[model samples]
Every structure is written in C-alpha cells, then in structure tokens.
Target: MEAPPVTSMPVTGGAVNMMEYLLQGSVLDQALESLLHRLRGLSDNMDPETFTDHELVYLLKGQQGNPFILRARRSLSHPTSPWHLRYLGQPEVGDKSRHALVRNCVDVAASHSLPEFLNEMGFRMDHEFTANGHIFRKGVMKIVVSKLSRILVPGNTENTERLSLSYLVELSVLAPAGQDTVSEDMRSFAEQLKPLVHLEKIDPSKQRH
Candidate 1:
C-alpha cells in the first residue's frame, strides 16, 4: 500500500500564538541514573514513558537570509506511532528576567511518508541522529533525558556512535506567547533538580561563534 503524500499547512494561524519555553542542561553518564531517579519523584503520577527515536533535520534554502530548518522524528520502538514534524524559530531576545529561552514553534504529526514528501518539497537532509530517552511530564512542562548518537551511515540507524559521555536534559513547555509566568514555573521546577542537573536557558545562536 502506498502512503499518503504529506502536505504543509499553516501551524501558526490560530488566535492563540504558541511559543516554546525551553531550558537545557546536560549530565555526565555516571550521574544519569541519579537524575532519572530524581525526575521520577518530581514528575506526575503517570508512568515515565521511554522512547527511541530517529530524528533527521532538514534544511530548505531560499534566496535570502538563513535557511529554514525542520526536524522530522519517528519512534523506532513504536513503529505504529505517527512521525513528528517540527519547526523551531530562532530564540527570542527577551529581557534577562526570563528564566527560559522562548521561541516560536510548531509541531505536526505526519504520516510515514514524511521523508519522501519533504524531499519532494526540496528539503535537504542536514543531519541524522538517534535519541533514546525517558520522558516525564508535570502539568504542561515536559522533561526529556536522552543520549544522542551519531549515525555512522547515511541511512543506517543500526550503526551509530555515541556523541559523548553525557546525556542532554531538556525542560520545555508549549504555551501561548507572552506567558512569562510559564518561565517562572520552569525555573522553580529546575531548582528542585539542582545539584543533580542544572537546567538553564541556552541560546543556540550565541553558541555558534
């Protein structure tokens, strides 16, 4: 059977403009277990979900400015789940009082043929990686603790190399724009995990140079 062609739609059209609030930090491999244990205690009552995802980042270049980027992620462990397609704008330059980095973002669930469709739309695959992690949620906030691996071959997910001896920790929330209160809650939650993992707002742009 042939999969349906994926089409792009406006994800930011609604009345409520959505933004992603994010705080990022990392922990050494030896301390990953301890951080996970602490997260279990601080997270919601639901069982923590584990996932192994293969993610590909695609770039679309235009005549001007930086190329637009998109991330397509699929769960390797749960093949039946739909693929996640995400568009993340650059980090916002807000006041120092904001606890987390804020960015305009959109997430869409796509069919299995997403890669083919994206290729047809002129998006070039920039890079690929595997992320296996435990996910935790508290209210609207989401926490992901994952170790990233470099794909050894272009299309082989089985052959990979661990990127580093550390696990990347991300604390994120998707909420309406201008909701600075969300950052406050994230900061408070991050405090609880302190000494274990220190989550802070990191701007990717600043790290480029």
Candidate 2:
C-alpha cells in the first residue's frame, strides 16, 4: 500500500556544504555499481570477525550515492532536508506522546521486506540517513550505504541470485519534532513489532502460564 506523508509540518531547506557535494558526486553517483562491485568482492575479501561496528557504521555512512537518494537532498549532510520520512523495522524509545504518535503512524505501514520476500510481493523500505548522537550534525543527512544481507540489506548474501537487498538508505529530510531524530529507529522498530512482536515488563520467560 502507498504510505502517507510522514508529517504535516511544512518543509524548508537551506544551502549546501562542500562535504555534501563530495559524497553526492563521488559515492552517491556510483552506488549501484559500487554495491555490485563490493558484493562481487565479498567472496574473497569478506571477513566476518575482523569487520567491526565502527567499520559497519563507516560502511553504512559512506555508501549512499544513487540518483534517487540524491534527489531527496542535494547531498548527504546537506544544510537541510527535503521533508520528513520514516522506515519500518527500526527501534524507538521516548516520551509517551511522541512515542504514541509515531507508533500510530507506522501501524498503517508495511514491513520493509527484502531478499526473503524477493519472490513474494510486499512492502519495501528506504532507510534515509542523517545523524544521531555523536554521529551527525544538525540538519545534515549523513549518507549510510549498506550492502545486501547487512543492516540496510538484511539476508544471506552467499547464495541469493537476486540482490533484493539492493536499495537506498531512505532518510527523513525534515521532521517537526525537536530531538525526535534520536528515536526514529527505535520508534519505527517498535511500531513494526507492535503487531507481531511482544514485550514484557519483566522477563516473560521467567513467568508461568
């Protein structure tokens, strides 16, 4: 199903930065080609244990460069965003009011199905990147490019002929809520899990039926 606009607040954008242009022209332009190349290299060069979280974060941040993602903003970490956006299967934690509003928004949305859902028709996801605590600056959307079967692309990369995890990391350009960006993933993830997943105050496994 077609999703609704993330927020009702009007959007306004500012000027661009030198760094934004660098990422857009370089990595963003060759996202697909780069992704495919990296995927091809995985067989010989991939290392599971050596790969670290910072490296993963670096990979995620460095990879977005497709024409479509660039259309969302002049560049990643641009001075401003196009508008508010959302994603499925992210995590959320916050005040009751904000959490409730976000939770409700995701209720009508579908999960971001990737490689597993290749043959099956369903909803797709775009995880737009900006910044978070200690990560991004204000109003600057940092480009986080992920490979197939990874965080942005979730599934097994070894045997799948179809690279269904191939997609851009869709980010929210502008959001009305102050400090709201921090909770985007958590809120989105909780919203997705609201229907099928359950959470308990204490450990549920310790309880008796």
- Report the number of the highest-lDDT candidate: 1
lDDT tens string, model 1, 1-209?
A: 31121112234554556788999999999999999999999999997899899999999999998898999999999999999999887676455788998777888899999999999999999999999989999999999999999999988999999999999999999997778899999999999999989999886868888
Q: What is the lDDT of residue 40 in candidate 1?
A: 91
* lDDT at position 45, candidate 2: 36
Note each model's CA RMSD in angstroms: 7.2, 21.0
Worst 10 residues of 1 by lDDT: 1-10
TM-score of each: 0.92, 0.20
Q: For candidate 2, lDDT tens digit of each residue in 59-107? A: 1122466211111111123224232222222112233443322211111
Error of 1 at 142 (Å): 0.5
TM-score of 2: 0.20
Cα error, residue 205 of model 1, in Å, equals 1.5
Q: Residue 81 in candidate 1 has what lDDT?
A: 96
Local distance difference test scores for all models? 0.88, 0.26
Q: Which stretches of candidate 2 lie over 4 Å from their true place?
A: 1-139, 149-157, 162-171, 177-209
Model 2: how far is 186 from its true place, Å? 23
The residue ranges of model 1 lying beyond 4 angstroms of the native Cα positions read: 1-15
